[model samples]
Target: MYGWIWRHLPGNAWLRALISLVLTLAVVYVLFQYVFPWAEPLLPFNDVTVNDQ
Candidate 1:
């Protein structure tokens, strides 16, 4: 299955690498901005305290 799909795509090695890098960075950005906050409490010393003047 994987081999057949790769054979159909007409991009060179460098093009494929660039596309994968961009996609990975996009996913990481989304996770850090949204998903990471929800799981912060589960991590040790991850609490963010706010002070009001």
Candidate 2:
């Protein structure tokens, strides 16, 4: 999968690296800004219980 993307990216090694870095940052931003917030409430990470014994 990664190899395919690298092959499909335009230009030489330096250009490909720059584009790949930008694409990775964009994906991270989108996931944190939108996807994670939407999915967070459905997850049980906030669930907490304390028992006194």
Off by over 4 Å in 2: none
- Clashes found in each candidate (C-alpha, N, C closer than 3 A): 0, 0
Show the lowest summed lDDT stretch of 10 residues, model 1. Answer: 1-10
- Once fitted onto the true fold, the runs of candidate 1 whose alpha carbons sit more than 4 angstroms away are 1-10, 42-53
**Which pairs, if any, clash in model 1?**
none
Tally clashes: model 2. Answer: 0
In lDDT terms, how accurate is model 2?
Answer: 0.99
| lDDT of every predicted structure (CA atoms) | 0.76, 0.99
Candidate 1, residue 1: Cα displacement in angstroms equals: 11
- For 1-53, candidate 2 gives per-residue lDDT tens digits of 99999999999999999999999999999999999999999999899998999
